[model samples]
Target: MVLEREILPYFQWLLGGEGLGLGALPQFGLVMLGLALLALIGSYLFAAARYGPLGGGDLVFQTVSSGFREMWEISPRRIWALARLAVKEAWRRRVVVALLVFFVILLFASWFLRTDHQDPAKLYISFVSTATTYLVLGIALLLSAFSLPSDFKTKTIYTVVTKPVRAGEIILGRIIGFSLVGTALLAVMALCSYVFVNRSLDHSHQVEEQSLRHDSLGGEVLGYQGRTTLDASHRHDVQLNNENNGQALGNHGHSHSITARGDGHVVSAAEGIMRARVPRWGKLKFKDRQGVEKELGVNVGNEWTYRSFIEGNTQGAAIWTFEEINESLDPAGEGLKIGLIVRVFRTHKGIIGEAIGGAFQVRNPETGVQSELTFFDAQDAKISEITIPRKLVGTDNSELDLFKDLASNGRLEIVVQCLQRGQYFGFAQPDCYLRLPEGSATWNYVKVYLSIWVQMVIVTSIGVAASAVLSGPVAMMLTVSFVVLGFFREFFVGVATGTEYGGGPVESLVRLITQMNVISPLEAGASTSLIKGVDAVLQSLMLSVAQVLPDFSAFSTANFAAFGFSVPTDRVLQDLTTCLAYVAGLAVIGYFLLRTREVAK
Candidate 1:
């Protein structure tokens, strides 16, 4: 899969420093413990100032001992019963109204979505997945954030408090109930979206009889070529032999399978139009015009620098080093199928609209033995496919086996270069790949939905934790702020660490006021010293908050289904682990918060 943002594998992510990894658990625990101690000290100071030192000490001891006691005394039966009650309460509140809201939004959604889009599958997938995600998360936020608070408002919580139900159980019960409700809604939405997208994109073109041409000399009937009638705002060029069988060429990222009919063939959409393309990706590095190896290629003047360009016609080339390229990668022995999403850029559009020439070369990493250049016209914004046969004629015109000569120790380097001197080819790490056997598109869709589900659970957990201590509106706002901040946590972390050029929040603000560029150094003085001093404290606070907030963006895999790539299993596992961690941590925190509240007591 082409990862726009890099993600670590399960083990690496679990044990790494980035995000809420298990390796950082000890440090996080220490931080939590330190905060707890600070809170205890703060309470004692307030109590001592009002009462006495001995009285303050006694109160702190009671609070600590009771909080632990309340948590430990949780009964499974009581928890389940409370969960059911919360579920009933949610139903009574008509949470399923969320589904109606979704349906109503979707009813008028067609006004914005264009049926004639070139990539209908992508557009539809993105729309449905994004819509479902926001709707479900919004429901979770409202339901979880307001459930306990509303109970308190109505004094309904007093009845439960008078019963054997503990404060800890209430928090856990609310989380479980809200999660169950959200899960049911998510499943329904996923099903509806599946049907909706398929219905909207499903279309077939009729054979244009007048457009058909027969290759006949005299009376002999030969093959025929024709154009298909317009359907879904597009048409296709088609050809068939006397047997009345042929495939339609690909257009709009899809092709048609012509079913032979009496007079002409009926065109049907091909299976791969919406498929899970399992691709074996390789690590990409660039060789400069001077033939020096580098991590990145030239940055073409694009605002989005996801793709880098290489100078054409020179020794400059974008190379992918593929590891684990064995006979298994090509079990059929037909060849290794290479797929490319090329970004063609031009210094000048020489012929107004002409494809630039590009070439591919495979080299043995160990022996430096390279294959002869395989050339093709590089079209802009199109996926190009090429097959490398098992047998090959090398640049020296010597016979060679693709496996034996080119791939050394299962490592092969494929170089892509723009053949036109004035032209350039842009590539990201995921832009080129070795196509493997396709996986089930259904399973891929399920995985993306699973990602959305994890996100919902996380949001609900955050809201519940906040609501345990704050009012409903405040809790909702806090949850929303956390989610929004989570999206930019990495950048926030960067600023906190002084890695970003403009510095921290205050320093950046100063830069904005002075109209100074990020690269310039601020003039050193007491004002600057004071600015730095204040920014340091702010940075420290930002860093702490960044670590606690969930990285919500990591849970989105809708792009996987849209791009036709199967979602990576490791990422799903990583997300699941992250969600469970948040749920567990927040449950503990919420339990303590609820225990301190008068309503719960």
Candidate 2:
């Protein structure tokens, strides 16, 4: 439900084959290499102007030789000593007080974080993760930006420079030291956040014995239906049988155990309410009212085109072709769980506040034979689940097994149709998926924090690199500006690639002055040609900048966790690799910057 689009694996996303796939590394390396070459040529030209041609060559050779020598002869012990000193210095600066602040916020968090919230888990996780991210990133930026600059300001850097400590060592030492501190802070906070979210969402319910009613057919008792005692401001509608009296419907993101207590049912073990449901996504296609296959369905006049609409009381339906069906999908031998999140768009006021009715049925892809419809009511944007019985009834009233008769040759076609007139069902490809199984909720929460940590690493590196050549306040400004730009990296790409409206910056300004629509082209003339020419150049520059920016959107995975979906392992690996690459590049850049900076030379 959180994922509106199908996620390609990391390798596929980066156009790499497999394993620790090369993602943006090829292009990133080329850019860095080009910049390094430019820096070398520029340094040599500056030296020549200042110290004559022959002396310039000597200076250049000495700089390059010393750089290589320092790299090869770097001492880990010396770096560790300096890193330990940094840790002591940070303690002296009262960095540990940030954790106290985090604790205080958690203590008072319940005042605003309502326990009765419809999705308590999502609310708690969002608040905790967001608060922790801002706190940690703020601490990192402030600490790293001021650390080296303050040493230089107090002339304490002179003491360290007198020793054999290499410029590279100083930079790496500071990065590692601050990273360790941030890691410690993050770990404690992660544990506390985990506890806070779980505790805030923790509650249990008991079965309401008085509410039990017999589910009987032909004067025989089949099962019992009842309601659970209210807890956490909500109750569950339960259905159970005496044979295996443990199954119950999920009410608040989880289901409770309903066991037979003598003649009565007992509901207990309210576990796994906030869960990560592993889903196997299928390929989505559309069928028009005339029953013709199409690539996409009708767009129902919405600006955000994430979901397409299927008209009601017609042949319009969304078809999902699921492949590689196997017994593992139904390991318990129970029916397959079909999870759906759909949006109901109503044009008629018939039966106000009632949910729209929709039908789901499976078809054989090869034989085109379809099963009888399974109906469920859908509310707007609400997630509904239905279990397709192991034995399905065909349209011809023949009982057919789900695996053998309908799901032909390991492929299953599920069709979704809206039954009411003047109502529409809108859904994206990810709106419907077969729920496979659940993973650890705690593990999923940790993955969310892992993403936050990567972001912290990136911000800290930016701060340190900027501080290498800039004053504390100015470096803070630079890092902040970079982070702001990073958050809008997608928007920048959109404009640069002309996917979004309003052309390039120059063209946008032109449109603003003339009050022209973003979609409209500039009026043809000599002046327009000149404007467009400048825009073209600007677009290329914009693209180059966009490619270099940190992808902040990709680093955030709260939605996936919040909506009870497992974050892909490849995504985590790709982000960690990206963080490492950024750190390595920043460390090198910081070394060179300090080498040529005023404090050193």
Candidate 3:
């Protein structure tokens, strides 16, 4: 029952909102991809700062040096030479080699660290965008700090200062060269990731389309195992036939006890209950394959059983069972033998064993008058008996759960029979039948789509991102930490909200005992926003914080997908934009800062 708001409606908005047709463009995943690409580029620039001739100082020096040379109308060759010197000098540093080696190792390792997941679109896009930013940023910082410090130590600035080349050119050129190289590497990685993601998305789209080819219908099906129980007040209708001398029984809502004596006819206390049964030897109508009508002959027989009463010393009452007889008998003779059979199985009174020996008629409770069906033969056994509800009969052996074209097949033909008293019998019970038709139920797609992707993207993005910024040792440490954190963000958040120290005793204990803990510091980060107000500020900060490591919360859309909800494309775009903007922005700013700072020579 989770609504769109629960998973952040990005997909909902992108898929053309609720109930809208699929958009021409797959907006949400695309938007996220765009932002991820942007971030990838930003991270690349930051990484490239190491291998080039210029350093951070080159920006200021390049502007001044270039401006002066322009005024003097110096040759373009001289300007090019100066730029080349800056790049060559920077590349000669051991720090540049070390940084490039580190980046290349990470980039290559990423290729082998494949996930077993079937869907790779979100996972691939998320990993590349996040991992590149973090790696490039760290490399940029290391190169900037290491190379600049060496330049100072070796007094290299003094030599460069004597030349026409300005300090800014040295710094800015270093930044540009490193940026160019790193960005190129990242662009390749991003392209590969994009291809992987699109393949996954395309596969997902095909699956959905394939499923829509057929329709599903649902309805109530009575899975009667032997028998079905009904409430005491339950009632059913019985059809009457004039040719069979059929009379609907149990019509007046009166309860009756039927007893079969050593007699040919059944006696009933309530005339209404006794009259409902149709004579077994009667003409029945059914349809043949060519839509033609046919008649079935039913024969009734009387067998004796007893209704045993447990309340008053286990009294026995007579009951009868009717069996159908089939023979080539004349139509006129059928009337003399045709009659209904009533069998009683359950009763409020007690239990039954055999047929009664002598009783033939019974006094009605309503009229206080006697009603009779036959004479007592005295030779039938005097068996124990109990009054019970009458039984209905049907073949009920269909292979399928639902009946096909039930109405068109015509009404079902069967006799109502129950074992009452000591004899096998039939009572005026309602006829049994069934019908099957097409029907529908509602399904939700928003939640289904949202739950799946939300968790996937959120977990993979944050996990890889955290791995990027840390040292080889620290990266592994952060990877494990972020993986757990990503999986249990809400649980950790709740702990943070309720704990005295805002995180938990675990965090507090760790702080007191050691510098390290299982929960990530980045867990406290917020998500970003697209709006433009105080709310937007809060949202932006939240989004930025959420991306601090790699929030995989968005990929939890699997649950929604299971529920058959459609995800909108826009929401994915928003998330991607927010994440990419933050990461890339951070990387770019880090790059700019790195370009200004001097690196060790």
- Highest TM-score against the true fold, candidate: 1
TM-score of candidate 1 on Cα atoms, chains taken together:
0.92
Worst 10 residues of 1 by lDDT: 19-28
What do the candidate models score in CA lDDT, each in turn? Answer: 0.84, 0.83, 0.34
User: Model 2, poorest ten-residue lDDT window?
Assistant: 14-23
Q: Give the alpha carbon lDDT tens digit for every residue of 230-261 in model 1.
A: 77788888887878777677776678888788
User: What lDDT score is found at residue 310 in candidate 1?
Assistant: 95
Give the lDDT of residue 472 in candidate 1. Answer: 98
Work out the TM-score per prediction.
Answer: 0.92, 0.89, 0.25
TM-score ranking, best first:
1, 2, 3
Q: What tens digits encode model 3's per-residue C-alpha lDDT throughout 505-587?
A: 34445456656554445233222121113343443443443334344454443322222123334444565555444343333
What residue runs in model 2 are displaced by over 4 Å at the alpha carbon? 4-6, 13-23, 48-62, 206-230, 240-248, 258-269, 396-399, 405-408, 506-537, 598-601
Query: Could you tell me the lDDT of residue 324 within candidate 1?
Result: 88
